[model samples]
Target: METDGNGSMEESRSKLLLYLKLAFLAMEPSNCLLSLAIEAGGGCITQQVQNFIVKECFAKNMKETTMNNQAYIKGILKKVIANVESSSVCAEDCLYEELAHYLTIGGPPEENNIIYREISFLSSDLDGKDCSNSVNLVAALRCSSNMLEGDTGCSLWPSSLFLSEVILSHPEMFSNKSCFEVGSGVGLVGIALSHVGASKVTLTDGDMSSLANMKANLELNKLCLDVASDPMHPCAQKVECRHLAWELASKAELQDQRPDIVLGADIIYNPECIPDLVRVFSILLDNDSFGEDKREAPSAYIATVIRNLDTFNYFLTVAGKSMLSVVDVTAKTQVPNLLPYMRSYDRSSVHLLRVSLLSE
Candidate 1:
């Protein structure tokens, strides 16, 4: 019985470690952190768990970026301290020391905060390799504290994360292909495409601020930004950033783009925008003029989280009317969970659709 009890405790601790790691990676809210810490401590705030939160999570996060919300960190520490006191557990000295440090530093900067996220992908190398063989792609993204800023394109959504994982997991599909992404928020998917050795990558967003932020992120990652005279031509540099509003984009301009693959992440939300979005898709995916080489035609991979049934159905209706066929390939395709540490990202909520122009 004592041995069984010991095993149970060990299992709980293991689970706690996973929860803590995920919470830190996903940058969960302060309240969520307090709850996770409590769970890590077996329903109480333990001193050891407090130390882990301070030394492992908070300290590491602070060092990773100067743009981190110091006030938010301080608040989380205070909550942890209060929880420890309430639970009759003594909090670590480092927690108080960090809280004092934050008090001196004051709040985060007024500018948008930049977060460096390391997205790891488990390598498909089947040479009897272990989990340690995974690869990490680090991206520097500027995101607003408020979710609605930059037309909501400045925020990192779960759909983008899911799409990025799909790209990384299926490198063969994107490698050496010319890929274009619409509504490329934060340019996470663009970075992923470059990592997978895409021959040419074009990232476009309708929002000016989002476009600027995406360009900054691309520059931060040291990926060259190519501005081509002909948007249809393959980019001279590995990545290209463009200001493309679906509603405003000219049909001639859309027809000029000759990408082999098209991609979008979380771009199917607005019901009003569905018509223009599908119109853009129609021009891009219509390869009847390019001859009957099916392999040469562009295919679209859209990752979207269906928040409203009406909005999604409306998109489908608009797409079908635009001579586009949308197929749900989320189950058909085996996309590995590359970002296992991102607990905040509900990949299950995202659905991958394969879109193409119907045969003439």
Candidate 2:
């Protein structure tokens, strides 16, 4: 059976543009992009497709595409043009010039790669219907380039992604609530909190560098940093970043925040940090209103990837000692798969734990 040429062509266009959007923003290498190009051109990189890529995709961010990591762009462009020329398709002069520019100013491997990730909360637009022509936009994050380094909050973890999805899916739980996040990496969850109308959002990180990076990300998203001082400003984000080393953080300081809700992402990896983390929870959950209304009891929603069972068990034991109830609500809470476009994010890898104070 032969498929209709027009139907096939539309499918090709949709996939090509969809892949290009992913490629231009948050892709790793050019392998997927390369395959998409060939597939879109009906088994070869046609001159039309070549012009589309060079003119449409790579032309957008000249500085980001050419600078900092000229070597990275140079390598990708080299392979792409080689494939095109091999297929007997005449490559464009603009592509040749772009290649020349990178080859002339090649440098060492890029320590930092600036990435713009566009997350969409599409419900059922998966069949290429209403997907290619336009995107149902969500938050666009300027992820830190320094995420390559180990042991830094500069990276975006799956737990954070899961937590963000949870916040977006269930805005009622956080709206008008004072929210505090421990181990807030890159401030993605804070941004989500702001989106969901959290009355106050305070993000804390132990690492100084990661805290600075998180501030930059918030600014990139146009979220106000110091909402307390800039209260009158229309763009006040009600989001602030703080240096909170769990081991050294004082109970007096945590008590001052008086957050109604506590959030954490991927903060359960280290056994050493469990004691301080549980202690921080205890202090944050300690509120005078508990005597009056049990409904006012603060809750901690922790999203973590259980890498080690023993380490997670240690957290449970410590939380129990601190009179905290840790319940696994990953199954009961049905959070919409908001981030269906991000291929790298695995929702199943993350587990959501609801923690609350237990009566003594």
Candidate 3:
């Protein structure tokens, strides 16, 4: 039996290699062989073929079709992500070779194009299965950091499950509103918002590395940042990457204007930053006053994979308390209570808590 098992493992490895070769041979420059690999139960095989094609593209004079093919392979990877349910095509160093070149070589500039991005969901490929249980939204966003943070599942706000659910549920919330995402790591949520027409979106993150990446992603997607500070310009919907730390988010930095929507993902994991996060919320939400203009008070959304429920609950409790206190401190409007703002929906270890001044 031991010998038989070893033989089976070797056979599986051989079949995988054979299928990978077939997939590579089948994928002509314009043909749909890429799709065939997906249909042939060749998720891993497709990945290998993709890697090879990427490398070949780089070796063969740094072609433009390589970038287009990168997008194509990404589409297949999305299918692979959906099929596998728990594997990551984004290996630690396995960037689509074509995109790596574009990032390093630079692409066409569009300082006047609309920028769209999504935060952590699945990799839009086979990786989606890993977070199948969480709520994800297809939020359109505007920012340059869309390309900055690509460390697979590491860093802040890296998953798209929760954000996708939000955008699908509340598309109108961002349709014409000016949206601003704090700590827009990789500009996922912010970019998705821009994709769906948020009117104007701003992606804010503190890391310079992430900001540079965001710019590359924006350029890759045919979006660009404006040279002047014109808010009403046609390309205002395009994403802008700027450095912003929650601790330093003051009137001087935010320009004293609260956004119609404020969003964060995976920001609640750190208990030490809770106070700073709350303070940033207070200042950005105009002291948490929904007032008569519920639209004006800045609807806030946060999505986190609840690896630790204690941390999740802690954030809910803190958000509730802070929002109520802001209400009392800002105005005498005794409109809605805080407990009602703390309703939650659960999905396994991943929990969705809607915390705001508005009663659901």
Question: 1-360 in candidate 1: lDDT tens per residue?
Answer: 112577666665655555565466456666766767777787787888887887777655645453465656667778888888777787778888988887887455566455554344445452233333334565656665676544488788989988988888888999999899999989999999998899989899988989998998887777766444444433346688899999999977887777899999989988889999998888888776545554577899999999999999999988887789999999998987766545566899999999999986
* lDDT for residue 25 in candidate 2, whole number 0-100: 50
| Ten-residue stretch with the least lDDT total in model 1 | 126-135
What RMSD, rounded to one decimal, does every model reach?
Answer: 4.6, 3.9, 13.4
Off by over 4 Å in 1: 1-22, 35-45, 62-64, 109-135, 149-151, 226-236, 291-295
**How does each model score on TM-score?**
0.83, 0.81, 0.51
Candidate 2: tens digits of C-alpha lDDT, residues 19-107: 65555455445776687677667678777777777777666554644465455567678888999888778887878887887677645
Please list the C-alpha lDDT of all candidates, in the order they appear.
Answer: 0.77, 0.77, 0.48
lDDT of 1 at 269: 85
The sequence of per-residue lDDT tens digits that candidate 3 reaches over residues 134-220 is: 323222233332234343211324234346445544567678777777767656566667766787778777667667656656555
Q: Which stretches of candidate 3 lie over 4 Å from their true place?
A: 1-158, 229-233, 251-255, 287-295, 324-351, 358-360
Error at 217, model 1, angstroms: 1.2
TM-score-wise, the better of 1 and 2 is: 1
